[model samples]
Target: MFLLSSLLCALAGHVSAFLVETSSLTDLYPPLWKECPGQFSDYRVENGVYTINPWLYPERMGMYKILVTFTAEYFERFAPNNEANILWGLPLQHGWQYETGRLADPTDETKCGRENGNHTCISVDSWWACMNYYLSVLPFFGAIEAGVLGISSDQVQLLPPPKDQMYFCYSVTTCRSTFPETMTKWSTFFQQAMEPSKSWDDLLKYLWDAHVASIEEGRTSFDDRSLYFPKPETDFGKSWATAMNYIAAIRFETTLQNVTKFQKALPPRLLKPDDPPYFIEDFTDSQNRFLFLLHGLNKMHNDSGHKFLSLFRNLMKSELLRKMANTVLEQIILDDNISPQELDIIFSGYI
Candidate 1:
């Protein structure tokens, strides 16, 4: 009996060790995230990186992060976000920390050598500094899209949404990069679809019709992925329940994958010679819908700035908006304009 008890103890210890040492986000991934509620108890080590998937507690469904922490040697070389609150500040308590395994510049391939080891590859730099450069520098172009090209903030009669919404250009820019060719197609599509309209409904119908036509032509285009619509409910086609389900699906499928890190800026695109990949994950559909909704709200506020916020809040709960989206998809049929070669390019871009 004593031998059996001793073996059981040993087995329990081994199981505990495996749980802590695993690289993936063990049992921390919750289907729905709430506020960083309970104490953060789970921690696992994967591929030399420590990851906390659910982190503290999730308050929202779409806000989880996986954090990675590096070893002492690598931490000394490539210092990542180590402070507890820093990673938790992100949405959904979803984040990761990498103690090591980050290359300095995309051009520099050598690993930052171990502690006290003099290495030629180790460049004197901070991860924060590198991140700052990207977020601050390149993202100006996206701001130009919303601020200069789309509409100026000065003209905006309504106070902007929290920085969480208005300052998401970095994420949009990254989304654009994911499908450069697709974006090119989108640019052309939006250009044609953006013919001056009297109301938001007019703008939505124009784009929705175009999308349906594109799909019929064998193009895998989205219905409302580009947030360019103004009035979402000129025509109704789908039930509100269906629309909510769609939104939930969009949130679920779209996730953030940390390709690289930067301080407060966009990092240099690690995948290519000239580009710094934008950090942060986003739902392509949600980003578009949010943008379009904002643009429409901006216009409404301009026209009737008196009740813009109230209208927006109401619109959030409007069933007509969902019907408009669904009606557009169901009403129109598309013919493909993109050549077979263009399709090939689009396929390559996703990879």
Candidate 2:
């Protein structure tokens, strides 16, 4: 019977279709799956119904079926236990195994904000909330990138950046030369933006101040060279500046929220509890900050024609997606008897 149950679980991993319902507006981050190679084939929400393409169609050569049911409260309270057992049960499954966190017990009086949202009342730790926040902003970036690049909105593909475009990460050819030039210059400038040997709080302060300064500087530069790109007919420089500021500001706010959440209560697995303890203490507060800073600097690099956007592109292509999944798993095994490294391998090798 256990074997049969396991087989059923295995066969049921391909949940290409699902109906997710939540109580409030904020409780609306739908479950998602992404196995497709090129396209943003993972998560798309339309008309309040989310679709996660398992990418099991053409490759697997048959229709596959799996059950994905999410209630925001259930996800918050029991995600860790459910994810660990389910993922362990069927390592060969096709969807992501998420293990979200809990604040206290499910029946606690806190009630939090959203009726169906996380019990913790903390915003960032709520996986569904974070996902919703990101999904909301993606369209804005899509619109702006299109107008600035002088291409149709559809031309700006978000995830798995087009296979054809020359990239520093996914493409072996581009990384050899193009990437280094872009990344090196940006890294050097970014280091200057930071004060040497500062605490996380200090570092964050530095970042916020530097970014505000950069925005002012960027505005001036735009005023000076406003005549260069996209010809005078389209007013592309003004559009680009507006779009760039929107992107930068959004990134800063999101990064600040994310950093604050992870610092408060990141899963123990992401940081080895056994390792010096302070290392985890220092980093839980600071890890994702670098990525945001990297992204902001990359934006400046592209706008300035520094070519460093290529390095950022490469890093995303190779590492970002995997890193995100690893983070999800990290929370599950926190302070538990599991080898995170081995589990990462199992995750990478299997689903």
Say which candidate scores most in TM-score.
2
lDDT tens string, model 2, 15-96?
3222121122113211222332222222364543323321112111111111111111122232321221111111111111
Candidate 2: the clashing residue pairs are 169-314, 182-308
Best candidate, lDDT-wise?
A: 2
**TM-score of every model?**
0.19, 0.19
Candidate 1, residue 304: how far the Cα is off, in Å:
2.0
Tens-place lDDT digits, model 1, residues 241-343: 1222333211111111121111111111112222211111332222223223333334444455436445544553445665564443222211124332343
Candidate 2 to truth, TM = 0.19
What are the clash counts of all predictions, listed in order? 49, 2
Error of 1 at 120 (Å): 25
**TM-score of model 1 (CA atoms):** 0.19
